[model samples]
Target: MPPTHLRRALAVSATAAALTVPLLGAAPAEPAARVASAAPVVPVVPAVPVVPADVVDDYYADAEGLTGEPLKQALHEIISTDVTTLTYSQVWDALKVTDRDPADPDSVILLYTGLSRDADANGGNVGQWNREHVWPQSHGDFGTSPGPGTDLHHLRPSDVQVNSDRGNKDFDEGGTESPRAPGNYTDADSWEPRDEVKGDIARMALYMAVRWEGGDGFADLEVNDSTGNGSVPYLGRLSTLLDWHAQDPPSAAEEARNATVFEDFQGNRNPFVDHPEWVEEIW
Candidate 1:
């Protein structure tokens, strides 16, 4: 979480944190962010295998079937629940991939410098940096407005250019192939999801999908296109590339941003990043 100053800015609802989806054509100025590769140090825990597409459908089906406050409560439970023996802010911060000031709200810099030491043995990988949406603040999600506790899906750290290119557009098979889409919505220029980041995206999508599965029309943000079509079925349809992205993991800058955001707002760390083994389902 950020320091007091940044938190204050969030309270006013004027900063980016206060808005949900960006307006039409609204995109961050930078394009594909860079990511550096140091040594491929193996994870301490066993790798959480990506769920097969068919299995992913099972999870989706189960999540989709849920409705009403039951879905919302489940989602809130996921996001609001504190990881075992960890505070919410601590878990949230662990997943950040960007560098940010504990006190600044606009400094969500997704690149790494010589100063980063959290993820790398030799300080940090200065090359692996990318802009991560604190909340997959999709510009396409209608009626999005950052306020007290808004739905934050579509969040992930990726090449800045790729994310920029995807600005506010839904992941649809628009002749262009997008790695960001699930099998249903493929675009040529869509995000080519990394292994680690895919899972991260999945987690966010799952949270939203389950939460809004039963919301009223326009209120549903979770499951989308019940039949695996392109349109978001409800307000919380999970993004397709979540599993692949999570496997690839967010850049160091994104991890940092997650940390700062949690510290500033929810006051928790990102448990998934810190303890990758806890993840069971990733598509």
Candidate 2:
């Protein structure tokens, strides 16, 4: 007879072997040594895809080789041309499509909370999503008019309370982490979006600054280096926004949202989304 310890090991191995065997000869059972030494399975995470080059070909042709104010001007001209505006009412339907969750066709992704909620769950009640103006309409006092007020490029669905928490606050780093929306922080004067969408917020601000150059009846939106912009046609902490733009490059989802706005809802695109490098070039 085998030694006591050796016999115990053999018994356990025999049970494992028996359990692993197929009722009908499915295939030979893996050797005990092979099974014991096998590596743990790691789930594969797919890489974020990039927008095809052809989609942006000649779209920014007029803004090429330009920098600073000239570049800003060129991009504004490029994106502002023939934009189809939606009504404040239509924003509900447009956001259902623009910010729709990729994994769930019936849901849309909330901006600050990153929660995927049902498309129809929009209202002023708690625990629901509503349109969030990336560039607060009050800062520029655009209200809910059909122009900048309804621009799909800047509007997104966000949790109701989270939207109010971020109300009219400028973007910056550091604050107490929000209880309602983790990863986001807020101070008296500024609201810092979560890291994943920090670049998205920054790009939206930059796009607003460029697209609304005070040429139209609306206020001339601009970016500044300070906070507490309060009803002014400016958003701030530009230096921080620039840092965010570099830290978080455009994601595949963001690029797709830009394309949807251009191809379906809005007739124009957010240039910064298409060409992130142009942010530093102009700002």
CA lDDT of every candidate = 0.33, 0.73
Candidate 2 Cα outliers beyond 4 Å, as residue runs: 1-52
lDDT of 2 at 165: 96
TM of each candidate vs. truth: 0.40, 0.81
Residue range 57-149, candidate 1, lDDT tens digits: 332232344455554454345444332222323322322322222223332222111112122221113333343443333422433333212
- TM-score result, candidate 1: 0.40
Candidate number of the best lDDT: 2
Look at candidate 2 and give me any clashing residue pairs. Answer: none
The regions of model 1 sitting more than 4 angstroms off are: 1-5, 8-75, 78-141, 147-164, 167-190, 194-196, 210-218, 223-246, 249-256, 268-271, 274-283
The digit string of per-residue lDDT tens for model 2 on 57-172 reads 67778888999889988888888886767799988977776665544556666777565678889999987789899999988899998888888778988889989999999999
| Worst-scoring 10-residue span by lDDT in model 2 | 18-27
* Full-model lDDT, candidate 1: 0.33
lDDT, candidate 2, residue 235?
A: 96
